[model samples]
Target chain A: MPDSAFAEIRNLDLFAQMTDENFAALMRGAYVQNFPAQIDLISEGDPSDFLHVVLSGSVDLFSTWNGRDTSLATVRPIATFILAATVKDAPYLMSARTLEKSRIALIPSQDVRAIFDVDGNFARAVVTELAQSYRTVVKSQKDLKLRTSLERLANYVLRQQKRSGEVSSFFLECEKRRLASVLGMTPENLSRAFKGLVPYGVQVEGTRVTILDQGELERFAKPNPLIDDTSV
Target chain B: MPDSAFAEIRNLDLFAQMTDENFAALMRGAYVQNFPAQIDLISEGDPSDFLHVVLSGSVDLFSTWNGRDTSLATVRPIATFILAATVKDAPYLMSARTLEKSRIALIPSQDVRAIFDVDGNFARAVVTELAQSYRTVVKSQKDLKLRTSLERLANYVLRQQKRSGEVSSFFLECEKRRLASVLGMTPENLSRAFKGLVPYGVQVEGTRVTILDQGELERFAKPNPLIDDTSV
Candidate 1:
């Protein structure tokens, strides 16, 4: 494998256990592509032929309903997307688009399958990654189904704080509009939710948010392992 | 394996790959426990020490948020819960409680791990079962995030109709209250939604639901694979 491609594979948890030779064989026919900002990398309902690894920039995953689209998640650099579908040979569940100018590695699903079968380590790594992804989605489901819109935003802020290791402040990773959709709410409702959190010690300024009181926010959000990051 | 246990294992997809001798060894240290209705069998956040197989009756898997609990799903006879957590040695995300008088098989996680390392067929079967369980949870997440309550109920009716076959009316396997929570709606709202669905040609007579018009419900639900099934 090329040094650069090897570095890319190292970043993916699914390829964590791959031997150098196995990794090279797996990527023998794979190639990289650069996508411009806002490019639709993969559309929902399209057949998934490649297992995508985001090499650089970010990918936004969202789904449309009745002409309205909502953000499902943002795939950061060094992670794979639509992997379960790729393994299951199913169509993409949500459309993925580049949030900024990005580069992605495309490995044919057939190669992935072939390599996966021969590499127990690779298969185990895939199992772990897929399980984590599955848990994250389930947590997101619990968030959507169990919490009100305001509660969701409050918890989201604390989760970002935990991710950044800055209890007081963290920059918003995406637009409020997109964030709202990801949280399963309307943009206007998300705006209103921000205002609602003022009493809970949250302050939002443009794309940067500051938490004035962590305890108060936690009291309102009630962060749990299923919803927020304790290990990270 | 005992004759009765052998007959039971035959019905489970997870154990379908096992030969009789292989299965007997796997079950050598396994034990069975019977749970009465409404018993809390497994609590969330506890260590996953054993792999649970529902031998009879049913189980309700759910998570709590802010002192209120939301139903995640139900497990009928012969299904397993927390397999991923068991394999990964992670904390349980959702608690499992008996919904009916039940018989459950518990195999120590250590025993499962031991058998998994030596039995290639069992290892493959375990991975396959974990992958499928993970995908089902992912699909449930899609069900929660990508659809409104009414849409969820509509799609749920279709799913139940499919599960129970083309009968005019079929009894719900679980309680209406738990079903309401699983569908992410209030009992009151579920009641109103049932009334609202009269136009869609679905009728809920007690726990016996009749899909009077499948075409209308399908159109109204707009069931997409990504949102409905097979997306994960």
Candidate 2:
């Protein structure tokens, strides 16, 4: 890896605590690559050979069954995906694809496990990262089980709005179809969900969303931190 | 904790590899108790002060939103739940309750973190456990998003049957109402879902489930290991 890329990764929480020698050992067999948009990086059920770190652009983590595909999550810059699979030496549960031209660092899973066995700092960081990942998924499962599609979309808008500097208006993060899958709704239902939120002062045109009334939408969505807040 | 209880917990993978002294330190502030059925053990959004281990019986991990309640998972004997919350020192994301008369061990979260900072084996075990958990949740989310209620029920029955030592007949593990919530469907819908599987030879008599035709059900359920096999 180049110095600049190495420095960027070193700054990430997962790597920040690791010793320089161990970090170098982990990066020894790793390589950085750039892929065009819509490229498949890894497939579900494949051996988790590499731990992927997205340095730029975005990746969509998705799964398919019975002729249906759903987006499980989207990985953005300065984040790692498939670490759980890598650590467990298990098959990847979700396939990842590039959402746009992107740069990613691939570390061999063996190295991660090898270092984890010997490095306390890396092991602690891994535990923290996995714990965070586990909580995020639990929160997501709660969202899927306890809310209606409209309620999900409303909360999603609020979350995205918060991500975008708490702005009143901002562009949606991904395509509507992918968003629909992530929210566990059909595209038609997503459209109707947006329409359903109109009463709460949410307006959508193309990918742009304007929350005219945050309080009104909050009342309708009833966003709970335990369910919607990933940061916590 | 009693010596017998310590031995049982020591045999668990999470604690088996730690030094005896470190294990003793963890157990110093820990205590075990028995709770009656339907007793709430932990509430969502409260500080995750204890790492709970179910010594016997079962506990339900669930969430609620806007008056709607859903079952997230059931933790049966000889395993831990809410470790993510405990390690993160974050609020409990799911409320836990005993589904039956249960014995539980509560270890102080601080002790878990303190020992985790020192024990490589325990930290690695935590990684392994959390990775397994992360994959299980991903599989479940895929089950919810990619399959209909009927498909989920079919796959669920197949899974339960496997759990029953590949028997053709066994009782459902939990109440139908809880099963419905766990499958993300209404109780009425769950009833209809069971009926929908009749053509494939699934018979439900109260909680008694008899699979008259395993091949037919697996054909319908597709039973992808990626989604259904928690062991993997």
The prediction achieving the highest lDDT against the true structure is: 2
lDDT of model 2 at position B123? 90
- Compute the DockQ of candidate 1: 0.49
- Residue B23, candidate 2: C-alpha displacement in angstroms: 0.5
Residue-wise lDDT of candidate 2 within B1-232, one digit each (tens)? 8887888899999999999999999999999999999999999999989999999999999988899899999999899999999889999999999999999999999999999988988998898888888888988999998999999999999999988999999999889999999999999999999999999999989899999998898899999999999787
Give candidate 2's TM-score: 0.99
User: Per-residue CA lDDT of candidate 2, range A164-195, in tens?
Assistant: 99999999979898899999988998988899
Return the lDDT, model 1, position B50: 88
Local distance difference test, candidate 2: 0.92
Over 4 Å off, model 1 = A230-232, B18-25, B117-121, B230-232
Clashing pairs in 2: none
- Candidate 1 on B1-232: residue-level lDDT in tens? 3568657866687777767776777687788887889999889889888889888899998998777899887888778888777767788888989988998888787777666655555655666666666667666766776677888888888777766775767888777788899998888998998888899988888888887887888899887666666324
Per candidate, the number of residue pairs that clash is 0, 0
